[model samples]
Target: MPRLVAKGRSHFPFLALELLTFPPAHRSDFWSPICLQVSAAAFQPAARSSLLEPWCRSSAEPETRGPGPRAMEQQHLASSSALRDTEEPASCSGVKEEVTSCSFNSPLFQQEDKNGITYRIPALLYVPPTHTFLAFAEKRSTSRDVDSLHLVLRRGLRTGHSVQWGPMESVMEATLPGHRSMNPCPVWDQKRGYVYLFFICVQNHVTECHQIVLGRNAARLCLICSQDAGCSWSEVRDLTEEVAGSEMKHWATFAVGPGHGIQLQSGRLIIPAYAYYFSHRLFCFPCKARPHSLMIYSDDFGVTWHHGSPIQNLVTVECQVAEVTRTAGHPVLYCSARTPNRRRAEALSSDCGEYFEAQSLSQQLCEPPHGCQGSVVSFRPLMIPNRSQNVRDKSAPSVQQSPLLDGLLKPEEVAGAPSETWLLYSHPTNKKRRVDLGIYLNQNPLEAACWSHPWILHYGPSGYSDLAAVGDEGLFGCLFECGTNQECEQIVFRLFTDQEILSYVQKD
Candidate 1:
C-alpha cells in the first residue's frame, strides 16, 4: 500500500487516489487506509469499496522487456494531471474515466498569458549597456489612429531579479511620414552599434468605403541609434537613397521581405531584400509576379550596396539567414523560411550568402503554414580553455581533462564540433498554435539529430508574432503578436534557458 501525504488544509472537496504495486508474494498485505475528513452527511459507505478496488489492484504484469508499468503510469499521469487547486466547480462528467500514472522524472517551466496573441515573426535582438532591446512590428486595426510599430527594451539580468528594460517604448506615431502600418522585420548590428528597421510604408492613399486604400510607396530602411546604451534613442534616418534605392515592394501582407543582415568573415555585409507588389484590387492571384528573395552586398557598411538577383531555382519568401561557426574551423550559412507549399523549411549554404542549395533539411518545423517572418542565430561556445602550455608541461597533451570527470574518460574524443543552431518559428501542433523552439546540432547541416524534439516556449489562445535572442548565451527571446488588431498591447519579454526549453517535452 502507498501512503497519502497532505501538506495543507483544503477548503473545497478533494479527491486522493493512489495506485501501488508489490511483489506477488506480498499481495496479501492490506493497504493503509486513506484518511478522509469529510462530514458524515457527505460520506456514503457503499461508494468507498468501488473507488478503492481500482487502487488495490496489484496484479497487472510489469513490462520488464520495455519500460516498466510504473514508468508508463508516470507518463500518463504527467500528461493528464490538470488538477488545479481553486474554488471553481468541478466538472466530473467531462473528466476522462481512465486513471493516469505519474513520475517526477522530467521538469519544465512554461510561462503563458491567456489573453495575448503570439507571433513567430523575427526581430532584431541586441544587448546594450543597461538593457536588452527587441525591435519588431505590432500590427493594428485600420480603424485605429495609427498602425502600431514598436521598439521595446527590457532590463538585462545582471544581479538578482530581472526587470523590464525600458518603459516599454513605442515608436509608432504620426510625426514620421510613411508610417502607415507596422513592419515585422528588424535587424541589429552590434559592431556599428545601430539597429536597421525595414518596413513597407504607404503614401498617396485614398479612403474607400471606410477603408484606407494604400499604394506602394517606396519601402524604407531606417537606422536608429542609442548612444547612451539604449537609454535614449536617436531620431530615425532614411537609408533608402543612401543604399541606392534598393527598396522592394510587399509580396504578402504578412511577409516582411528580407530582413536578415549578416556580416560575413570576409568583412562584407550581406543584406537580403525582396521585390514584391501588392494590390488590394483582388485579382485571380492575390500576389502576382513577385520576385523571390533577393540579396545585396555592402563593402563599406550601409553607405553603398551592390544588388544581386534572387538565387536561382529556390522557392521561399520572408527568408532569414545566419552564420553558423562550427567547433571545427568551418563557417556555414543557414537560411529558414516559409516554403511555397506553406511549410516551415530551411536550407544551407557553404559560400557566404551568395548562393544557396536547392534542397532543404528533412525535418520540417511547425511554422505558420502561410507566410510569416522568423529569425535564426548561432550560439557561441560558453567555455573555451587556454591553449598555452606551461614550460614544465610543454610536452603534455594539448588538452587537459576536467578534474570533475572522475572516471568518465574516452580515448578518442571529437574536437571542434559545430555550435548548435536555434530555429524559432510558429507552428501548429496538437491542435494548438504554438511557437516551437528547435535546436539543431550542426554535425551535418543537412540532417539534424532525430532526438531533436522541439519544445513549446509559449502556448495559449494566441500564436507568436516575432522572436529575438539577446546576449551571448542566446537564452531569452522577445516575442510579438501575429494578429492585425494590435492585440499585443502589453509587451512580454521573457528569459529562458536551453535546459528549460528542452524540459517541456521531457516532463513525465
Candidate 2:
C-alpha cells in the first residue's frame, strides 16, 4: 500500500483527503504548529464510480472521443456536470460558482485566412500591478515540436468572476534570424514591473533527440521583455553563454519552463528549467543522456541570472516553482516537476532556488505514461466564505482564527498577516494517458501529502497546461490544450473562483 504523509503541526482538523490509496502518515516539525493525518479511503468514489466508466471506453476509441472545439461554442458553461451530479455535494448550492471557459486558439481561428494551424505548450502569467493575464503558446504548423515556428500571445483582464480576453497576436520580436521559437515561458517581476518572456530558439527542423544523440546543444536560451503588459516587447537577448557559461559543454540540451516562473518575497526571481546531460562510459564513447530539473535565478532583480544544480537522484523535467512560508520565520522554495516515475516529484530549497534538499514523490498526483508538463502557483489561502455568504457553517474559521493554520502561514502571516500560502496545481489526471485535466489543492503546501483529490476541470482530450492566480480576490485561470480526438486541436481557457475549488475539496 502507498503511504501518504503530512508532517509537522498540532491540529490537522480541516485536512483534505488525498486521491491515493494509503494509510494516513504524519511527521512532527518544531517550526510547524499543526499536523494532519487523514485516510485515503475518504476520497474513494462511492457507487458513482460507474459515471466515469464511459471515459475508459471512449478514450480507447479515437472515433468516439469527445466533441470537437465547435461544440464548445457556448463559452459560459457550468463546471463539469458529470462531477456535480455524480459526486456528493460538498457545500451549499447557492454560492456555487459557474466556470467560464473559452477557446482561445483553434484551427477555426482564421489569421489572414490561414487554417489547420496547431498551437501547443501553454504558459500563463498574471500581472497583479496591472490586473493583466498573459497567455502564451507556440505557433506550430503541425503538432510536432520541430514544426514550432514562433510564439503567440493573448492578453486578458479580470472582469468580476470572468475574464475578458483580447485578440491573439504573434510575438514576432521573440525570434532569432535562423531559428524556430518554442516554449513561451513568462516571468513577471512584481517589484520592478517588468514582464520577462523566456524561450528557446532551435535551429530550424532540429529536434531535441538529435541534440541528445550527438551530445550537442542546438537550443539557445533567449528572452524578451515588455514594460506595458504584453502590448509591446523588446528585442530578444541570448543568455546561453552568459547564464549557462561553460555548463553547456556537458548538457545535451536544456529548456526553461514552458510555464510561468515565480518571484519570492525577498524580491528574487526564479525560472524553473531542466537539462539533459550526458552520462559517459569508458572512453566517453556513445554518451547517454539523462534529464534533471533545476533553476535559473536572479537576486538583483532581473539584471543577472545564474543556474542552480539539478536534482541528482531521480530524472525530472519541465517544472514550475512556488515559495511557501512556515509559521517560524523564513520561506522555502517548492519545486514540482514532470517525472518518468508516474508520480509527481517535489523538492524544497531553503536558500531560494540555488540548491534543493530532500526530494519526495506525491503519490496522489499520478502522471501518464511518459509524464506531462504541469503548472503550480502559490497564493494566500482565501478565507472560506462565511455562513452569511451562503456557506454551510460558521464554526470553521479562517486561517487567522485557528492554530491549525500556523504551519501554512507565509512570512507576512507570521507577522500578523491574515492568510497563509496555499498552492493550486493543474495537470492531466489520467494515469493511462494525457486526458481529463484536473486541479489539485494543497492547503498546507509545506507537506507532500496535504494535496486534495483533483477537481476535474475538463473531462476529455486534455494535455499541457498552465495555471495563474487571477488577481488576489480568490480567482484563478487555466490555459490548456484540449480537443475531441486529440488534445492539440484547440487551446482552451477556463476561469474559476476559490469558492468552487474549496467546495470540491471540502465536500463530504
Best by TM-score: 2
User: Candidate 2 regions off by >4 Å?
Assistant: 1-115, 279-286, 384-419
- Candidate 2, residues 230-252, lDDT tens digits: the string is 88899999999988998887787
Q: Which candidate number maximizes lDDT?
A: 2
For candidate 2, give the lDDT of residue 46: 22
Q: Assess every candidate by TM-score.
A: 0.55, 0.74
Off by over 4 Å in 1: 1-124, 128-131, 139-161, 172-175, 204-218, 241-272, 277-288, 381-451, 482-491, 502-508
Q: Residue 389 deviation, candidate 1, in Å?
A: 32
Q: In model 1, what is the error at residue 61, expressed in angstroms?
A: 52
Error of 2 at 372 (Å): 0.6
